[model samples]
Target: MAAKWQVVREMDANLIDTALVEAAYANPALRALFPLVSHGSLQFSRCTRFPWSQDLPSIFPYDGERHFRVRRLHEPRGSGREQIGGAVTADEAVELVASHLPPGCGPALDGTPDDLESLS
Candidate 1:
């Protein structure tokens, strides 16, 4: 089957219900994918890539399963870029935000470009 990629515009703090944070974190896939959701979230048009191939919304509906809506983003890629985001747990929020920082340019920040961790 063909892959489906969702270009996430922003991380809706409101859409993220507190009750399901732990469940999301428990799943290894969800934890690994949270970072991508946080990337380039400074602006709406920034486009944070996410994975929505597995009927995630139907399986793990947010909030009331009908009220919660994750704004689906447009992908310029011919088919898809690949699903990269998911329901972020509360504890992962801090780390999630930090991982999406702008890239470094000065020497004081860190070593070579290869050593940098920020996504830019």
Candidate 2:
């Protein structure tokens, strides 16, 4: 994935989605990850750069019901993803994501993963 990371973000209140906000506060750990929206769904990244890896789970709020859904993004795009579980609240959804986080996963990287690669 050598494409640039282009995320649609509107700081304006009217353009923002409530679900994105809900997912942000779902968990402190989730809050720590870089938040972004993909195809109207809330997704988090472990780094603030392009080509977001499958390091974190993607969460979606069902049809404005405010019900959160946590899913694991699998490789080979369009192969479908795994449904980890569902949550009545953002907190619960993030809790599920938190448990599945990679071992030793910390706050999102401040830079691209490539930045780290160069450091080593």
Candidate 1 lDDT over residue span 1-116, tens digit each: 00111222223545443333433344343433322223212111122232222111111232443222232223322343232234543334333332432233121222322233
Predict model 1's lDDT versus the native. Answer: 0.29
TM-score of each: 0.25, 0.67
Best by TM-score: 2
RMSD of 2: 5.5
Q: Give the TM-score of candidate 1.
A: 0.25
Q: Which stretch of 10 consecutive residues in model 2 shows the poorest summed lDDT?
A: 1-10
lDDT of 2 by residue, 37-106 (tens): 7655667677777766455777776556667778886752345788888755666676778888877565
